[model samples]
Target: MSMPGKRVQGGKQARGRAGLCQALLSLLLFTLLLLCVPVRAEPVLTMGYVEFPPFFFTDARGQAQGTIIEMARKVTQRAGYQLNPVYFPPRRMEKSLAEGRIDLWIGLDTFELMAHNTLSSKTVVSTIELRAYHKPGKPPISHLDQLAGSQVGVYFGYSYGGWMKRIQDPASGIEPVFVRIRSQAARMLTSDRIDYLLDYRGPFESQVDSNITGYLEYETLATYNLYFVLSRKRPDTYQLMSQLENAWRQLKREGEI
Candidate 1:
């Protein structure tokens, strides 16, 4: 009777020890599983742009490529965010950004954007030199007054450094013709449909055909600084802008941008 009681007590202790060991093993496996799993990435920020080569445009393989696009990617990554570049037509790009359908835009800091309920970065990420291109036979332009009495082909929806008002004034004798795309403006000039084509030098250098460029004469009209524009409609608009601004400053200091 004493031996049976001792054996029963031993079995109960053994079962309790085994249960505790199994639980410990299970917890270890669960912890290892968590460590092996990857953490989710940060949310993506949508970058809006129109085709302005050397600043933002699509390559032949349909990949987004340009100076500002490259900078934006680095800045967003540094800010713990991912970037998703989206293409829009010139007019639509502005509207989408204003309505907050697009989160950010990398372009000129303009007065019109102020009324769009947007905030712009203080960092001057880039600058665009507006240029007037004419046929080689025509005299090179050095001043805005020289464009008087001429039909100038310009990009639609562009401010052109607020020179539009001056160009459109009846007393100025300048007639403005608008093109939806830069390529159209180039074609119009090359085909002699317009007296002059006004565009940016950087874009012309990046996209215009070599043969076409040889036939054109260009003059710098104005230079405008580019900034990151954030739409006010986002709930975290101020916070997002602050993150981007900090990232940009850091990148500048690191000489990475």
Candidate 2:
């Protein structure tokens, strides 16, 4: 009877040990799972873009919408980043990019832009033509010199084939009336506020029947390929750039870029 009683007590002790061991094993597995789980935080990329109608512009709903906007959305989203678009004058955009306030800039290449610590994507996104438009009944501006001393309506943050900087110089004798948006260029020209308005040729002619009209004509000055410039000094710039390159390559294969 004593031996049987001892065996029973041992059995209970063994069972308790087994139960404790099982509970410990479960706890270990739970801890392992917690360690293995990945933390996913989608990084937000602040992108700087100027107003270029038919390509980049604000819709009536006050949302930025255009071809460039669509492309940006796809590339950034696929790269695991959310895009935050910011509008600024071309000069200020460059400054903001250099200062690390803007993470990306979408524009044509130039020595000035290249001087910044940025990485240009391997793909050429698109081409834009710098064209000058004039109102009806006026002689067509066949040459740039024709309006040496006249006021030319221009957007604040766009590169007019480097002509913006040259003409903006005091010695150039050409007056530049910088407008906040692209829509105002056509209106200012028709209203005689500016002698000629500089705009992208393709966008200016894209209008089926725009709100502003007066037998407008334009002359193309120069065509430039636009590129996506990533900041070298900004945080997570390299990772974002790598993602951009990957997205751009895939897009090229699909003929989307």
Candidate 3:
């Protein structure tokens, strides 16, 4: 005959200890669950875009959309980053890019452009052919010699290769009229304000205005190998470039680029 209440008291003490152990084990599991969950940091990149047809532009809803914009989205997503697109005027694009105010830009033909703080990706994203437009019945531009003393309409900040140097020279006799937009250049050509308007093939050929298309004849001038660039003053610049190259190559393989 043991003490009458001793067994009951022992049983209660054991139950209480088990309950405390269970509580501690549950807390440990909760702590482990918290550790297992990843806390993702949002990496952000600012890309500079200009309004040029078939590339990237702001739509009526004030949102950026286009083939180029879509590609940007894909590249950034693949890189585990978020994008903040900043639109710049053609003339201001390179300046912004060079100063690191924008981390990336696309369609750069001249590799040295924005050379100060910019590094181009090792991938060639696109090969673009530049074309010249003149009013119908105007003589074809077979060579640069034909442009002497003729007024050629060009967009501001556009690079026309060696011809640009000649145009800039006062003695070259090639009168270059700079316009802010391609449409303006086309309109100038249609109105005989200029003898020629040069731009990429796709945009010129797809002109929505009949008058501009009906009056223009085209000739291929140059082909440019364009690349995307990363600003040196940005964070994770090389990493972003690597991601961009991989994503771009994958997209190209899938026919999405």
Highest TM-score model number: 1
Predicted structure 3: lDDT: 0.77
lDDT of 2: 0.77
TM-score of 1: 0.79
Write the residue-wise lDDT of candidate 1 on 80-195 in tens digits.
99999999986688788888899999887563654667888887878889888998788788888999889998777777767877777889888899877666678889888999
Off by over 4 Å in 1: 1-32, 35-38, 111-116, 169-171, 180-184
Q: Which pairs clash (backbone N, Cα, C closer than 3 Å) in model 2?
A: 89-157, 90-157
Which one wins by TM-score: 1 or 3? 1
Task: Flag clash pairs in model 1.
Answer: none
TM-score of each: 0.79, 0.70, 0.78
User: CA RMSD for every model?
Assistant: 5.8, 6.6, 5.8
Stretches of candidate 2 off by over 4 Å are 1-39, 59-62, 111-114, 181-184, 202-214, 235-242, 255-257
